[model samples]
Target chain A: MTILFEIKKNYELQKVTWKEKDILVNTDCGVKQIRIWKDRALLDWHVRWRDEVGKNSLAVADRMIRTSEGKPWVDMGSEYLTLHDYVEGTHERSGHEKRWGLLIGNMLQAGLELQEEFSSVTKEDHYSFDACLAAIHKLSKEYNELVSVKNSLPEANKRLNLAMELKKASSHVPLPLFDSDTHMNNGGQIFNILFYRGSDDYPEHGYQPLRRLLTEWLKECGPYSLRKLLTCINEHFSLEREQGYLLLAEILTPWELQDCVVQLKNEELAHIVSYVKSFEQDWDFNRILLHCFTDWMDDKRKRVAL
Target chain B: MSHSNETVNYGPILFQYDLYPEKIEEVGKVKKVISRRGTFALKETSLNEEEASWFTHVIHRLSEIGYHQIVPLYPTKYGDYTVQYGNRTYYLMPWFAGGDRFGLTREEAIIEEIGKIHFLTLKEQDFSPEVVDHSFQYLMQRWESRQLEMERFAEESERMPYMSPFELTYLSHFHHMMRMAEDAKRRLKDWYDACHSEKRYRSVLCHGKLSRNHLLYSHHGEPHLLNFEKAVLDTPVRDLAVFFRKAVHLSNWTKEEGGRLLSLYQRHIPLLDEEKSLLVSYISYPEPLFHSVDLYRHQRERYSQIEFVHRLEKRISAMRHIRDFCDLILTPPPPQPLDTNINTDHI
Candidate 1:
């Protein structure tokens, strides 16, 4: 007998047909499935939502087929089977950077509307930057002991070192963060918001989705992609000048200073020596990072950056 | 928080390619320099000599194997992929297209491509007895401790008049959790026994992570796999388990659909009974629960009481679905052995 026999019996459906597309092993659940659903209800939603993205509104609700009565989401489990219409098509990964930028802009705009509409919806209080620093402080001892024999230069070591320094650097300088509710601080105080394209489990360190997307566009799309993305952002959203500074900090400093050295050709580096020079306490580690890559940064272009 | 002291000039850099740039613009961390040669994107990063060489080999090998989607890293006129400017290394490549998975046809195509990649990268490694033992020991210790922790939590929950939200959620789903946990332990032990007895396993270049995020589909609808940053030599099942885990995430797909997809993979590179069993065991572990436990323990100071509890509750719901799927996978029909003889390298 098919697994759906039970679900059909329980749901009292006129007719339910589904194809099990894929199976996954999950830590939360031992086994799960990727399914394509065909029932009266989802068929309606799918038919309607086929043109939603083309309609210039990312109204996800149209595509979001509701679950069966009493169920939370489309159930891939054998026992209580339900489904949301599966998005089975392929999205082109490259080209049309301006288009993608516009698309993302639309999404962010839609997200902002949704966020406001669901303002009363309970927010999940996630870890804050203050807490992130504290967590890194607690884990620093473990990182030192866990150094393995990697065949390459361990970027992990550098990340850990930078993360630790970030604790001190961020204390005095407030970072403009993304307003992603998924990745939040202790008090639910969000500074900036940006859409992340990766896994829900992992959020990038800083909230510079625009910067990240711009890099992707430059490398994978066309030269005008960043301009398009910025244009989309400008048309769809608003920002403060300080947020622009945060965006620059999140971006310009590539892991290696030399990557940007050529770009830094003719500029007077901001003298941050004065800022730290006045601070008697808490400025020790921030001072160290400023000196780490001074050789690569010409003396004329020497300036303090957080 | 301060601006860079250096003003970025792309003119001198563009001269390295003997191309006069019409315009040079900052695009995120990289520079978009347009010259008569066409638009080239350059990024500077820190990488050791070995690392760069390995990446070059991997990308080139894939291209050589007819997977040209491994965006060619254009060598400098000096024939170097990386150009050292100060302490940084920069490499430029032709801009390739990127796309996401959409309808069913594309999904099938992407899966088929993965199967092909796995087949091409397949290697027979001598089944290391030490590796098996180490993995088994780690599994046993971790699961055993987790079982203990759950039990302790259960005991405390029973004693308290008012349970924490997480405790309440756990208790509500307690039976499902315990049953699945026990089954996971048993399945792993069975796999360990099979490994010890069979003493034959094949290794393939595992993508480590094969989410839709890494896949790039061109306008012509060809699939391109990206990012070998965390590539590892492991059993083909390592990749399969990851793919499977993600495939079913919040999906309405069934085991039949999953089985069909696996069959597609098997058509390219078959899996042995041992491998299948290992994959099942691998998927059954409550990794999400442990992740939640870690978050709860380490960052309780950061997240509110409701936040953590709600998170756990949501996870518990997902776990229930996983339980059903794992039960089906781990059940009695043994996997058939592949006909072709795959002799792995004796490491």
Candidate 2:
């Protein structure tokens, strides 16, 4: 609070107090809120978001009021901070979900427009998407090797338990069939390693590159964590329907993220769980997983009947 | 909805209207019937249960509201607005001896009359707010998808060793069309916000296809809106948008000329800032470019390149006019202070 006073700004600070979640400061111009956070990247993302949506009142905060030197934020040695014009209102919590759907519809409409405005932005921000895929492939190989020697190596006991779980989860995905009887073990083959080795249209399955991406996304991505809240607002659909699409996809996957701990870091796992659990109530991910898994179980059911 | 015969047996139709017909003449799609009582024009069109009833209701309502510019002359006989003859729905309207569409004055008068019709059609409805938002969303979705396809096509075409003239044109002007689409979407937001914050959307009885053919001019200096086939209950700005698309194509494509036309229309029916914004958004779309590209892509090798190129050039010229008009509308008004207006008691 004193940092704002010490900044030697244009607007004279009048009254500073806590109004619920925000720290409100009434300046000579108007009331403004000060935002404090730890991560600079998150702060940078916040600044970009504010610039994109601030003017339009779609439940997003308005533009950040620049300091005297025209800087948006002040790196106060330990933490990052910014300022915005305080909007005096409260959320309509009762129908917030429906309201949220409309807000997202608004954002989608806005984003479609913004996409063109942003067309001049040739500098695309690359992500960990491809790297993450490569990491998963490497991890799957390690898990497979550990499982192959579970009986021989005592040190591989903990990893073998995780490998079994990963295998159970991995089998539901029908892919690149093996040519040799030698490769057909009781356990699942390492993902992509065997899959990529097959023909271009491997196993004569209809899975295209986009479908592979989607399957990978469903099996891997939890959600954008914070981006989901903003991006979900852009989805022009009813709350229940979108929530169904998300939960249904999650449920169809065999893994409950318990096996992901050995693969993904603690923060990553937490974020993934945060995304998976964000689905609407009464939607059973396990039941959906069980139902989809029946495709594989149906082969055994007929043989058992025979 | 069904199609009737080329020749209409006027006996049953006259019986319904309770008139005696001596002569009947087929001018175009409509047949002019001269009776002892009066002259009437009957035309058959396809409409389902709801559409027929709604169109009939809107046209009749306009006459009921004392709008004389439009002749909603559906004979209210036998408790029906339409007569089923030869498995087709038919409408019999009072026929007028219309002359050739002459000058700009006549065209301007007709447009002004349409603006009046739009004003008369407004009603307070809550659903309109939602409809505007939804329609805006739907339009954006379509534009976004189209732009994405164009991008994919461009990337693929760029890598090719040889490219056709159409492909060359598409690649060259891709960004401009896309930018226009973006502008349209942005202006749409402005319109949406205005209507949303005001809690009122201007829904009107729009003559969806307004053209010189649809406007019948008489020797006695009187004009009447004839066709009701494509009339719909939508935002009032739609009629203005359609009119401007046609008008600018017919006239010099300039902002001054366009503004004068709007002024002429505003004289008959004053446009709200929101409606003006909505109209700007509507016309900002590169409809001409969309159609030309569509034709080129669909026809591909069969279509003549030079002919298509000429057509594309003409459409692009017209599109440039539309873009210029949008610029006039979108010139940012001086910054307005944040409206502190709020229902304090409710808050």
Candidate 3:
């Protein structure tokens, strides 16, 4: 289980001599550490190596490896790893019923440790949670490689699959609600987290057409039709607890409708409605929602104004 | 105004005056030499009130910033520019004792020194938009007008008496070169237009005509720049390019010397790729050599045919080599930093 650190020609890491297994790269602002394991790709931890308290040494190592070539570096502190897993858990539980509980639990445990670390660092300097998440994803491959070197092949494969699934699921969820003030105080961790989630969940296939329609409609008809749609969903869901499922079925054609019931209950529907309402003024959010639900809309109905 | 014995007397100096002489003195330390044009005066003095005020301000300002080329000479209360003689207009300030004109020994050094001056002046000066635009436009107009004149000259060369048999042969060959120059001028106009339209006007103080005569050397072997009358705010590279054209083309200097001078310029100014390209193309224009040819033709009896042809050939070759030199300048070899004190002979 040997980890191989492949060095690119332009990699700044190559500019300095390092020990075969342990290397430290120092930039003007901070430091990064590289650890080569016996059975995985190189592991990098980056932190604010500047003279500051609560700077995660691991974060420095990650930054060192990620920004080795002077490209933008990521700082995936502990908090993001936990939030990433929490979002993945919510998605996993809602979308599919597999034995993802253990994986989610492990992620939450990691997230809690990250939260603790984040709290300590935020006391001094502020960082965004979204930025933290981005840093985590950026450094995930390297961290996974490090883990792979320590684990047996089958075990490592299982963890790799779980990590990949979590990455995929977390990438599809809408932006989460976090205290912007608190996030700003902690190096914008909250904003970073929300941004990461929003960008990741951005629908792929129908985005452009939906965006065009949304732009035209917003300009031509304003937010009247969007508010009506949300109101319709909310009223219908309030009438009957089970009507949420029925509303989903009504909105989607027979062939398009999923037979499986939504994992989120009426209360969750209310939460989602509130969440969707919060984004009524955001063009990007409206576009994403429209793109996500375009297939579910009735063809007979006039296209949502916008 | 009139002189006794056909000689002019101005204060202590006296000299015989000549309008059209059978033979002129080739060697002399005569206290005064005169021409019918005027009583020739020589001396060391400051500029007149108007000129002095201008030089004092320009030179003093430039000198403060390490530019020490043209120093001010103290003037008498009467405000004359020179002192040794009383007639001819001249300024004497240390005389640049050791320097010779462009073709003298240490030719490369003199060329490079000019390049250094060109680089420095260009780096320091700030020019007004009116000055930059006027000079650039003037040159462009002159080039356009010259193109038409050249075409007429080509046409007249074929007519009787306008061109002698030998002249016709020379004209036929010269026409080819002239046409090349015409094409170059057309291209230069376009380049100038592009530079202007791009708003790439970084004017520098320039010694408008940087010829061998204006560049001098001090006794200590340091290069000294002189003559500031033609100084203006314009493209500094024009000065370097003109010097280059005169040295390599008109003066028939070796390519090795040209290379040395160019290297010195590069070492001093580090020309940008675009500047190098513009310079190369500007020098390639046959207009300068064409004017030189016209001047030589008027003095043809005193010039040798073989020497004239040789000089023309050098200029044409220089014109052709301009593109290669431009490419060389623009795509300079990557910097290889060396330890200042390292001896690399073993390696």
Top-lDDT candidate index: 2
Query: Per-residue lDDT of B91-199 in model 1, one digit per residue for the tens?
Result: 7765444455446454465567778878898887787899999988987898889878877767877899987776676677666677777777787788888887988
Please give, for residues B295-316, the per-residue lDDT of candidate 2 as tens digits.
8778767679988887888777
**DockQ, model 1, C-alpha based:** 0.01
What clash pairs does model 2 have?
A104-A233, A104-A234
* C-alpha DockQ of every model: 0.01, 0.00, 0.00
lDDT of 3 by residue, A1-306 (tens): 011123322232233333233344332212323432221111111122110111111110012223333332222332111001011111211211111222212222232233333332221112233343343344334434222112222432343354345434544422111111211011111101211111111112211222333333344434544333333333212212232222232222211001101111222433534433332333243433344344334321344443
Clashes of 1: 46
Worst 10 residues of 2 chain A by lDDT: A191-200
For all predicted structures, in order, the TM-scores are 0.44, 0.46, 0.39
What tens-digit string does per-residue lDDT give for candidate 2 at A230-304?
Answer: 234425522233322332333333232323333343334335444334321112333333343333245334655
- The most accurate candidate by TM-score is 2
- Kindly list the per-residue Cα lDDT of model 3 for residues B73-131, writing each as its tens digit: 43321122332232233342433346344444555655555555555666533434565
lDDT of each: 0.50, 0.55, 0.40
* DockQ, candidate 2, vs. native dimer: 0.00
Q: What is candidate 2's CAPRI-style docking category based on DockQ?
A: incorrect
Alpha-carbon runs more than 4 Å astray in model 3: A1-306, B1-58, B69-74, B77-88, B95-108, B111-137, B161-166, B186-190, B193-198, B249-257, B296-327, B330-347
Q: Count of backbone clashes for each model?
A: 46, 2, 45
